[model samples]
Target: MGTGNADADAVLRILVVEDEALIALELECLLDDLGHVTVGVAGNATEAIAMGRSTAPDVALVDIHLVDGPTGIEVARALSADRRTTVVFMTANAKRIPADFAGAIGVIAKPYSERVVASTLDYVADRRAGRDGPACPDGFWPAPV
Candidate 1:
């Protein structure tokens, strides 16, 4: 666990809840490059929720539509119930997200760039540390708290 300080080299335990194998792999690799750990990768709501409970990751990057269907929202709702985990939607269907954000902190539009993802992770880490990070990244939409 991080002390919530950005300069502390916070190595977040992140879970990738994307169904696409390639995307998941890329995110895992990116997380490693960012000096963060990829706790787990889940391709469905069931697996996502299970991993969330078991791994207790600091953050979860979820896709709206999974292999099972549009069950990512369900996974978010469940995971966010545990304050230990912060949920962020990583979906192409941004418009499909409910206004409440399913208890998530924000949404990152798909086809994301490495820079954007890196910036977003930093912002999320700050927020989790109880610090208000800088303005949201270009393709990110922070949910109304």
Candidate 2:
């Protein structure tokens, strides 16, 4: 885990940006199980940006594609202007991630299992806590061991 003194149970406010309802709910459940708080869910980039501005979540889990014209990276860039918001991309098309988003804290490929999600959450939490340098969680791109 990344270095930090913050409690693992810390309630991190989070925003979920995904076009699919089922996936959004699943992500919410995963966040809940991790003791994180889901502040908002957006099906498109527009709403995601709006929610990010309004809620100012600690982190945002964004999918590459949204219902609207702008992509998740676009929303991340806009919302991240505050610099306090951490961004993670959850997408099947890892290769499609914007070049600039390579600087994001982490990326989780789709078809992720419970373990993968958990590890990603740990990585994010650690990053927020200032424990480890921002990097995609180990094994995030590979199938769960």
Candidate 3:
């Protein structure tokens, strides 16, 4: 657990569940620049589950649809079951998200700005560390906890 400080110890282990290779790569670069590290990148539900289990990432940035179809919802449900993992969806089809968010804590709409992604991750880190993070950004939708 972190101390709610934005230091090296606050770096979050991230898992990216997205089907688009280019987008995945871009996100990886951004995460790295933000001083966080990506544990793995999964293009499909099966791969996402396997990697998530093995890596036990602090956060998972998941897409609504993957290479195997709209299985990101299933992936989120499974990963978020592990109390150590926090799931956030990054998708264009926010409408497809069920009322419960399938166990995800929040969502970021696609075509997202890097600033939004960065702020969301910071907020997640703070909350994970038991601190009330900054206010949810404009582009983010936080599920009622």
Q: Pick by lDDT: which candidate is best?
A: 3
- Model 3 is weakest, by summed lDDT over 10 consecutive residues, at 1-10
In the range 3-121, model 3's lDDT, one tens digit per residue, is: 22357657999999999999999999988888898999999999999999999999999998999899999999999999999999999989899889999998999999888888888
| TM-scores vs. true structure, each candidate | 0.91, 0.82, 0.93
Clash statistics: count for each candidate: 0, 1, 0
The local distance difference test score of each candidate is 0.87, 0.75, 0.90
Q: Largest TM-score belongs to which candidate?
A: 3
Clashes of 3: 0
Look at candidate 1 and give me any clashing residue pairs: none
In model 1, state the lDDT of residue 1: 20
Q: Point out the higher-scoring one by lDDT: 1 or 3.
A: 3
Measured with C-alpha atoms, the lDDT of residue 85 in candidate 1 is: 90
Candidate 1 lDDT (Cα, whole model)? 0.87
Model 2, C-alpha of 17: deviation from truth (Å)? 0.2
**Root-mean-square deviation (CA) per prediction:** 3.5, 4.9, 3.3
Error of 1 at 100 (Å): 0.4
Ranking by lDDT: 3, 1, 2
